[model samples]
Target: MALTYTLDNARSLIAVALIIFISWLLSENKKRFPFFLTIGAIAVQAGLVLLLFAIPNSQAVLSGVTAAVDGLADASDRGAQFVFGYLGGGQSPFATVPEGGQLPFIFGFRVLPLILVISGLSALLWHWNILKWITRLFGLLFEKTMGLGGASALAVAANIFMGMVESPIVIRAYLDRLSRSEIFLMMVVGLATVAGSTMVAYAVILGPVLPNAAGHVLVASIISAPAGILLARIMIPEERKATELDYEVTLKYENSMDAITRGVQDGVMVAVNVAAFIIVFVAFVGIVNNLLGLAPPLNGEPVTLQSLFGYVFAPVAYIIGIPWEEAHAGGNILGVKLFLTEFIAYIDLGNIPADAMSERTRMILTYAICGFANVASVGIMTGGMTVLMPERRSEILNLAWKALIPGFMATLMTAAIVAALPAQLFGG
Candidate 1:
């Protein structure tokens, strides 16, 4: 039994390592021996795992992040109550809606409003130059630590708050001049991590399901950054000359009201797109599953698409340390996230039985699936990048498929780390 367990874990690690190596080899431009690059990638991947275990107070980081996210939720709820009064359904506001006085449409409503509130607040912070300063600090760190160019570093730093495409606009002037490797890195990082704008909505969705989930999500993004960079480099070695040290922090808003107005518009578009995509995709999935369900069964039971995904990805889930019994259940969530949207996967996760997944498995899955790396995201990247730099549209289109592999691998690397660590490290 002990030997079998050891072999299972070893196989899991070897599988992940091979995936990373193959991704690097296929993506690399320079056919030279990738000895150092592979080592560095492994080191960065292993470092994140060790940091979580070695640090004595790692849970403190998760705890602080949870408190901050909870505080944001509370503040948003308070503001919603103030603006909409009882109609907003804020803090027991629903009970007082006058016995028979038409209850407000509540489904798919409470959580989305938080997006608008967060958008407004984020704009206010940007307008006040607070966000710019923070971005600069992170940008400087990345530049110094990872040896990235000014524009690439800024885009990476800005990615923590803004979307992948939106972050590049920070250094829009340099997009034309950025090397192919840098461009790929930016896109991979974007797919591997979440933006702050949508973090609140994700928090609201996952917080109730997974304890300290909000913090874990945040940490996942941060830890994934280094891995993203390393993987990008391994795949496409920097062929062009690197940019020099020219860090300029500036908020290019026309004015405060414009910033707020633009932010609101962006937020509304995102919300509508999210709602529309979920409706269409979920319906499509249901249709496929229904059709499959009608087919002849092999095991005296009707087989469906969900079951296929569950079985196909079950091994992957197990490798990530989910229990044998619940591996398929967890894999189904991941498979859904990759095919559809993370938002949809998250909603499904929230609905899953608490007993279905162990706490560590849940946390690792949360980190793994927290990205915009679905099939649809490729379209988004191509469109957004073309708009930013039309000259590179061909390159962006050509590289989109290649980018997905590393993007997926980046998140998997994060999950591998979470899985390899002891449960106590993440406060599970």
Candidate 2:
């Protein structure tokens, strides 16, 4: 035990147990809790982690995947530079504060454009049947092990690569057929993983802070899918057998160009919404912080929203293997992710001084916040589901609240899994 793992990792395993217990406690049908389902879901995560991190051969393969993703982000940068010039990392006319220092990156010009390129490329891959085969392979795993019906299994698998609302489009005909539990699972898992387009963008933002950032986020998304499943079942056990056991991918596109065009259009909507939310939410936080500043000082510092949130989530941070000294900062990032946005949380993470937290804690946090889980996502999921099944609008709205905690817990569960493993697995 001492050689293969560290003492700190035990706390993370305990944290996972606590999360499971809490989910079981909150279950709508505790007596009907799916023990094997939980075990299977957990096993899937542990297996993937071992394959990707524990084994030398798999680690090299994982590295190759990450390198490919990094290359894709670099390709996106080329497109941005061509259009936005120096602001997008082209030669700069202005002088730097330090000689030969590169110009500061402008987020709109350099980063967000990755969404457009990646989204279009993803659509092209789907058109070529590449993603469909990948989705099917993963879907089969969930279907056989977790006992999810075929449609729900595929959607859950697709959530690893598609947006919450977008994944359901592949199983549109079966939207009305899903059980209440399955519907809630869909909502939670959707919130638990990120869209394929934003995954690369986030990796770019945190590249400096986290080595193999793209790989970690991608692995995090995959791990969170099953974590979400386990929590969803514990919270809302299957009331009836899932009706989607036998399913096929129904989503299609005409040609490669059409795929690219439609994907870019979808990417535009996501990019715009992301930009708008960042601007508005940051301003809103500032206004709230100003109001909080009016309060009396605590510990020689004026209390602000981040501090308050830090106080709330600090214990959670410690449980997930972050040292107590840095828990407050870690907690603040978690609070930002749950309440505002993971994108903002990642940005805040980038801004944190390197010396403030150990690399392991930073890696723990990188996986922790790599999801779409937030208050806003509840709205997105509900709205998207309602559009797909207008008849279930009221039920969807009602289940929206039930799914929120599970969604948030899913990523935390992923973090706990990361924390439980030896730091050596992450090259720390």
Candidate 3:
């Protein structure tokens, strides 16, 4: 049976409040007796969730977002086909294939071409200043509404345009001046967010396997942003005197050509890192599975690391509204996302036995696992921050562990919101 509205709202409210309380307890100012501050934070977080549901137009709002996401997917696909010609998975470039016959191509031949096309188009958009304008608008909204610093607000907003490290470059000049708490918030936000450029690729990869996959992924990221800020602030309250927030939109490049070139170069590096991380992490998981398989009853069986993760995380999956039958499978993907990257997790989700999971379970899991907050990303974030501000490298390193908790919490909060929504609203 579905949960009653009162029960659903109560559960969600308690979840948000608990997150704020936990954040305060874990932060450095335990001796400060920050009860009033904690209460206010919890109130704000709960109020946001309630506001989303309280509106009579809430369903329309979600539908509009879903439609916009689908439009972006359609446009991105068309752009991909134009840049890569037939290689981007359209009709044959030079020769036509027989009506029923399949094209002779390898994985890299098909997928890598799409990645290149998206990367190039992203560069072109940035060069035209389209992406910058969008970032600035979002930055202004976040800064004015959320009461965040200019640099942190801009970096978080730019996340929709670029990768974690790349977004930080938007406010590179202000990194050294940010307070320890603010720096921690920046890291948490970076970890919790996903880049827009990769959204196209992910949509293409999972669209075939899951309905509205692209739309859900976009919603997941957007919903996670506010939660990321709330959790990060709770973990480390703003301590230093507030500076005047600025909303300047500028791209650090010599020319349009240089911007495109640099953008593509950055994209290539991202793709390579993604590929390398997946290969190594999958192998490591295999090793662990092999050891686990050696147990007498499990020997020579198909038991894998995923199975273990499934068993370990199944309870939490159920708490997020996954059906009992599919919770274990959803749990496995969640585990992979946390330990490895979302790239591998999405691939695993696409291949998981359909009979083992319902469509609703799959959609919620996709939303839940759509962030850059994996264990591997921590090292990437730390190394990137070190280069950006050598003096604050120690501070970045110190806050790394705390940041991971809020980052993960942000994604979980998104999952909870989606889970609490009526399933029929998004075609679940």
Candidate 4:
């Protein structure tokens, strides 16, 4: 028992050390690595993972809270049904699919509209100041624990429930005022975390296949937030001590009706953008794969982009504690998420053959791929922030790719933390 515990701890520590070492290697000011801050950040992330999955009392409470994420998906379905009708919203008029027949989820109808409902609800929550209050509570934690500037902490906390670009909107006033490191940290944090509004769609797709998938996704977002801050600081140390900025809260609706209207409007735009991106990007991948397929066979099969990505990222998979043999499979998902986005990655994961990934590898990936980390996120975040603070657009562009470094680092760090835990902890 003691030996097993020692080995687990050693592997986990090594994973973290490797991540920090590599991040430090890329630091702009290599001499200024924030050792204590890095340690504190990792400790906090590890503690949160433990509380959610290892401690009985904390796990029970968190399970109840995260279970509500799944409930939100159900509620969104009811709303989706009202607008799109039964088949469109994915509620079959008949109770079951005919044997060997299909009721596969339709993305346009079933998955896309959940973003709308969540946006409207989010707008109303903002109007009521509920989200601000919630964000402030978390903001305080990061501020104290990580000694981050006020605006930076607030943005990171908001990333827990908001999308990458949307989380920074709350700090728009301070956007221009923030130091370079602070702005970069905010961007990376945004890319590193998934929005609450989008989690509903993810839950619907993954819930049936993975046990308590929503809960795990929720935990992944939470743990990734601090990791973003920590890695951001190490990779690009903040030169100036943070001064508390007067937070100007802007995400409010004039009234109940206004909230709903704005929410739906925002949701519509988001859904449209999402659909368009998926349509174009998926087609792009298909075209690219076909082109790659023309190449000579590797092993017994033609070389596809997906397999290439898997082989490329296989080492990262191994570092994150996936078993040696399964690392290639795990790398494929990690690569997909990094190259494309978690949306496509989750879709691939949901549709994989039963034997594609071991149960333990599946668990690690359910956490790893829960973020907005992708190559495109840099552009999305840069464009979004440029609109809010055009004066700093150049700086935003400069740090765009830099943001991806810690953005992915944060999420992958979370995956490694989970990978280090005993299989028994997750009921393997």
Q: Write the per-residue lDDT of candidate 1 for residues 1-428, one digit (tens) a residue.
A: 01123443454575567666676567656465456655655565567556754577766776677788888877766666677654455444344665555355342465566777677667767777898788778777667667788788788877777777678777876777888888988988888877776776787777767887777777677667766777777788787777543545334767889888877776776677677778888998989988897888846767876677788888878776667788888788888888888888888787777776677677778877877778877777788899988988899988887877777777777787666655655555
Question: How does each model score on TM-score?
Answer: 0.87, 0.96, 0.82, 0.92
Query: For each candidate, what is the lDDT?
Result: 0.73, 0.86, 0.69, 0.80
> Which predicted model would earn the best lDDT?
2
Q: Which segments of candidate 2 are over 4 A away from where they belong?
A: 1-4, 97-101, 245-249
Lowest-sum lDDT 10-residue window in model 2: 96-105
Ranking by lDDT: 2, 4, 1, 3
lDDT by residue (11-93, candidate 2, tens digit) is: 88888888889998898888987879878888989888877787766567767877887788778878988888777876777
Model 2 TM-score, all chains together: 0.96
Cα TM-score of candidate 3: 0.82
| Count: clashes, candidate 2 | 3
| Candidate 4 Cα deviation (angstroms), residue 294 | 1.4
Per-candidate clashes come to 1, 3, 0, 0
| Cα lDDT tens digits for candidate 3, 1-428 | 24334343335445455556677678666555445544443344345444554456765665565566556555644655677655545566454576533354323444444455556666667677787777777677667667776777777777755767787777776776778877787788787878766665566566666775666676666667767777777667777764444545335666778777887787777777777787899899988988877765543446788877888888767666676678788788888889888888888887766665677778778778878889999988898888888987778898887788888777776776666666655544
